[model samples]
Target: MTDETSARIAPPLTDLPIAVSERGFYSGFSKHVTIPSKIIISLLIVWAIAFPVNAGEVLGIANTTIIRLFSGWYVWLVGGFLVLSIILAALPASGKLRLGRAGDVPEFSRFSWFAMMFGAGLGIGMLTYSTGEPLSHLQNNPVIIAGEATALTENAVRSAYVYSFLHWGFSAWAIYALVGLAIGYVAYRRGLPLTIRSGLAPLLGHRLSGMSGHAVDIVAVVATILGISVTLGLGVEQFVQGLNRIGMGDWLLAKDNSASIPAIVLALMIIVGASTLSALSGVGKGIKWLSNLNLVLSFILFAAFLIAGSALFSLEIFARGLLDYVTALPALSFITNAPDGTTIGDGIAQWQLDWTVFYWAWWIAFAPFVGMFIARVSKGRTVREYILGVVIAPALMCFVWLSLVGGTAVELVLSGAGEGNIVGTVLSDQLYATIAALMDSGLAYAFSVLVVLLLLTYVITSADSAILVVNTINAGGNDSDHGRRHIMFWGVAIALVVGSLLLVGGLDAIRTAMIIGALPFSFVSALLAVAVVKAIWRDTIRLRHGIECTVPPEAKADPAS
Candidate 1:
């Protein structure tokens, strides 16, 4: 556990040359950019362009079909395995394992670390789903529908929050945790490249340098771009809704219009521009500052709602809903359908496909980008600490936020205190309209301003980190290649993907693309879980055996060997 051994634990750094002479617009092709990644990125650009131009034939049928076909049990197993991985890692034997060298101190403070992980892990998801998802489940949940409950009863409310937690809670974060742990341990402990391929070194060994490694990085880049773009698109949609809610839609768009091309362009330009600058500023300065600002803005918004809205009612729902979520975890985790008696509509199959299945796909798609970012900032922490920060803390915060925001909306609708149909409004305008309905004029205006600020910061945090993660993967895991031009390229790429898809099929097209992208990476995630466990086992053996460390011949191979 000395510095020498810790240093030895890091795999020898490989020299993957970047072709400087091949420069073009936005840090052109590098020699280090593997062929598989290059080809995948090229085809993706063409496909995205075609999706918009031939939306009728290309996106309407093909992409939707791909989403429907693969977004079933494939994603469910992905979710289940991820949750199991995180739970296992937190156990006594493995939980003590450090992400980096033994006794290494974390680079960022507890506050900064938590803030960054929370911002990167959830991004605009909280902004979009905090209100809409909870309300949607309350109204249309399979459990309630099967029982023939037309009204929002006490039981319906409990089930609604439980489902919301299921989507955003432990299962979602587990995907990120598994990836982060794998990459972090390999990069910090085993001295491997901090890329997706490196996460599999224990499992794949020297094959990591062959086509196998290239394929893994390619998948990571593709999934990161598509996954982050889906979030960017949703953030833009919600930002537009907030603008409209605050009476600024006319200024940003035409009269009574939402999701117009001009508005979408404006939002993307702002997001990509800010994110590029943040990426250039590096993780310590730009990402750190924005993350802190985002956390503060979030607190302001949450507190405003809690005070202005019914505090007691929201608190009661959150307290009770949290317990309900915990109590229902075992059944809910495995609940794919209703029992035989409920001769209801489609029962659990359809419900699983729509909500849980789609969410699993989205989280899987996001795992690489968020997981890498989490790994980058989490050096020197125990596996247990990482799990608590990455999984438990944020999930609980989401539950509370959902309770206060979406819970209040449901209460308002059920009590007939709100004007428009809350459920219908949630589907369209999401949190903005919900905030508008829940608060008075002054509070509503304040909430709207906070929403815009929070949205901007969260998207920037996501975009900047995604840009860095993509660059790291493309550069074969050398994070020091912080060329401004490279960061700008990825930043613009994210904007284009989201902007074009937003124009074509709107959010649905973007969602479909994300699910399709996640399908392949879901298998990659399963491999990573296996890799992490294997790596931990070897590390434990090494710790016990000291200088004459013992591992299998394959596990002991040096990079040059």
Candidate 2:
């Protein structure tokens, strides 16, 4: 086909606002917005008063029941769709699928970049699951998959890695990749505002520039806040629990339910201040620096776990678990907990439902923000580079972390060589229990403390970035710099919501809250199917036909009608 013919096949820009706002845009779609310091700090106070959320009851009976309805078949379909997309993304010829400014190479070193990306994206999960999660799974693997009432002796280690990898692998990455692709293409090529709604521009056309689009932006903003704040709350709780474990069980400052309103307020202050400062420093220096620190500390934790914990068992578990993960990946990727699901016990099926469904919900809920963040950071990069870096690189790093930390825990417990009950007490104190049980060295304890601190850094990194993303959705294109004062407002808002839920119920409460919050958004994700396909079809046609046309002047930013 002639260039004109080829271009004609591409779709026109959807509802992109004209002349992308350059002053505030970071990476690609993220913008620098401000939330106030006092407002930010006050979240801890609300959380302190909340003093333990009643998450299970708070989400109510019906919402919990709704989340439970997500069937294995649903995951099966989602996983399959995700795999198909990856295959397309991985094809050798995918190099031709350029987005904007053809041949935009990565500016940062590969190692530093990938490490930061992985650290920010997966930090909370890694820390949360490292100690207790493995041991619990080891004691009893997923009964449904094993065809038994309890875990198979050999399957415990394998299943943990299996589930970990499944959660972090292709499906999660696809959400990021597609969303990033949408935003990057629109913002970089079409020069739209760096907002989540911009990704939908190609589909919505000029209409997205109007009040109709405002609704979409609002939903995206709320979802982004809820998703990231929940994760941050979890991180703060982990920190408190870790401190307790380390024998520094002071005034319950770190404890969620146990913590006073003052304590919760303190934690919120710390997270928001760090987040606001980081936001000021700009994405490249602030986020990149903290992310680098996070990566280094994560590596240190892995090394400590490998060398000081149970070297032989860790290595053995790493190798064997990897093999089993590969073997069972397909089956485990889509396994569900609906009855006929398994014949375990009374609460067993419920546990499985809560666990698996909750994970899917979390990943799905955060997908939009994470995807938007990845796209923003990935400007001047190619499709191949983006896919490989965003998907492949992170998955491997997650596998390594699981193998080292949780894997070693399994080896210790199964071999009858360590205090197996230590993992059981993680809810009370994760950091100290991990350090005390794994190694007897002062150096090891020091290292563990450092890792804990580093974990804190990452929580800041992710939370701050999340705050920015959420604000971008809120302010729309009319404003990118709603100023630091404006941004801090949401940061504090997040802290209150998360802290209150935690005090009312803890992880269980958050889990229930997240599921409830996530239910409506699941339908939104389904809408993505129609949106992306329409976008692709239209954009592909415009590209093939080589149409270079001007979007209407004022309508460009308010094109929804």
Candidate 3:
């Protein structure tokens, strides 16, 4: 069980040969990663800002093409990740494998860990989509389009949540858990650096230490940036809408009632600036505090909905939705539709492209940042615990939020309390309209203010965590405080990306770019699934040989022994 014996029995886990700058502002940064990622992203920002129409057009064409070609790939690949994650966790041997050294304990409390995981993973989406998505699907989904259910009815509610849970449920988290588990196993158990390339080391071996590895890291960096940009863009839109609802007037929005360019710029200035400061404070202090505050505010908002909104109806929806989601998960996960030149088929196909395919791409693009953040905070947990926490726990929370928050919207619309406003409002305005329908003017205004604060915290937490993750990749997984300038650099880069994309084509442009960027990383994620399985299988063989698999070679021997 000694480290030396284990080292001799197991295949070598080599260190990545990434070059780090030793001096100047880029000190401790990997030139291979930082320079290329910055250049690519900077060029994108400039292009989007300089030629807005052309950039939007190109992005639109590229997004359409990629989605058309790869929609099935995105669905099946993500479903495979869920199956793989469950298999890995269900196996007795792999499930017991620890993510860190033998004596290492968890770095954060369970509450703090879950808070950060949930906050970093889906907090912004919960605020933006919990109400909007279910309401949208209630109006039109495959079930409604196929005549299986009437729009805005009870059966339609079931259909709505089935799709809602499909997007935000286990499959989405599995994508994140797979990457996090892969990187955590390699980085913690094998003593590799905590970077995307390190997760593939088990399969690619030493080849990953060169340009191939650098390329993987760069792709991950770009994906992370775009993913964060899309999230921030959506969050800013909702934030501006909240401001308008809370008496900021129509001036905060443009003629089309979307967030104006000036509003987006101002919001990003406040958000990214605060996020940069939080990134400097690191995950332990500022990020954790913000995440905790986010949860508190979230609970308050949820309580308001439960009390003043449709509590009994939402509870019923939650119960039935959970059942329907579980019953339909398999079909929802693997099934894809192609336009057959028929009405229902085309509607189904387009729905998949808009909702399901878009969500899969978003999750894939987000995996690097969220996965790395989860791995960073999940050092000492077992594979089963990690899966349960990353995949199961947060997903249950999402179901509740969708049911309660979204169910309230549905009930108001159905009961005529909303006077057609909730369903008729835009996505960003839907949450505010729901609040207005739930309470009187004074209470609704106050509630809107609380929601705005919650949105701000969620946005800040997501932005700061993503900045840290990008910096970690660029630093070759150093995870040290030697990259303050790099942190600020990424923070600014993300702001410019979000700002420019928002100005040109709003959330649509950012979504297009994210889907396109996610394509490359989807392949990388598939490799991660393979690598982790290979690693665990090989380590199982070693375990059968009486070789210790958890402890790395550098852990010191017991002095008494």
Residue pairs with backbone atoms closer than 3 Å in model 3 (clashes)? none
lDDT against true structure, model 2: 0.61
TM-score of each predicted structure versus truth: 0.89, 0.83, 0.96
Q: How many backbone clashes does every candidate have? A: 6, 67, 0
Q: Write the per-residue lDDT of candidate 3 for residues 456-535, one digit (tens) a residue.
A: 99999999999999999988888876388788888899999998998888899999999989999999999999998988
Candidate 3 ranges beyond 4 A from true positions: 1-9, 551-561
Query: Candidate 2 regions off by >4 Å?
Result: 1-11, 18-58, 72-77, 92-95, 144-155, 245-247, 253-262, 335-337, 345-352, 477-482, 533-561
318-416, model 2: which lDDT tens digit per residue? 677667777876776666655554455434556666566666777766766787777667766766777777877777766666667766666656665
* Residue 475, model 2, lDDT: 55
Candidate 1 local Cα displacement, residue 101, angstroms: 1.2
Scored against the true structure, residue 537 in model 1 reaches a CA lDDT of 69
Deviation of model 3 at 503, angstroms: 1.4
Name the candidate, 2 or 3, with the larger lDDT value: 3
Q: Candidate 1 — which pairs collide?
A: 10-190, 10-191, 11-190, 11-191, 19-31, 337-348
Kindly indicate the candidate among 1 and 3 with the higher lDDT.
3
